[model samples]
Target: MINEVILDDFSLKVTSFEQGVSTSSSGTEAKTIRFDFEVRGGTEYHDVTVHLYKNTFDVKVPELDLSFRGTINNYSTSRTDFTNENSSSLFRLELIEIG
Candidate 1:
């Protein structure tokens, strides 16, 4: 699990994080990391979009002592159920490492 993720000048305290690696028959390998977290009190959608628009960015996971140069392969956000008024906006980010 990753406790924190640093993307360029922005830092997020992630609620949950997962990382995976896969290899194809041709020996090509891919490294990916996914993060699940929330943003509160502001327009999180706009803020996140601006930072992730870059072709590539550096990600640092302090808990794993790992750094990756990656691209944003996928991203999604969903508002919390209406019943849970206290819940914050949930966001998911998936990044694939580049060669």
Candidate 2:
């Protein structure tokens, strides 16, 4: 479980989280983190979109004690239930450690 995720000036309430590292054919490795969040009731979709872009934000995971300035490699969204108005967004973030 991710204890907390801080992105720029906002703290997100994540529903689910996953993180891992992968190596490419050239043997280069990269870290990735993904989280799922729901936007319902009073939240505005535009507000969330404003904070996400190709490579425009910083990320921090407190429980993992990890900090990285990274990019949004992939993102997807879907409705939680077709019978309701609730929706969820999934964000996949690729991280690069700063020295």
Write down the RMSD of all candidates, one decimal each.
3.7, 4.1
The TM-score of candidate 2 is 0.69
Tens digit of lDDT per residue, candidate 1, span 1-99? 667888876888898899998675778887888998886534655576677778478878888887888888888778744344355787899888877
Candidate 1 structure, TM-score to reference: 0.77
lDDT of 2 at 94: 42
Q: Which consecutive 10 residues in model 2 have the weakest lDDT in total?
A: 90-99
Write down the worst ten-residue block by lDDT for model 1. Answer: 79-88
Error of 1 at 71 (Å): 0.7
lDDT of 2 by residue, 1-99 (tens): 774677766677777888877676777876677777765422445566566653545788888887776566667766433233364444444444322
Superposed model 2: Cα runs more than 4 Å off: 41-43, 79-99
Candidate 1's C-alpha runs over 4 A off are 24-26, 41-45, 80-87
Residue 9 local lDDT, model 2: 67
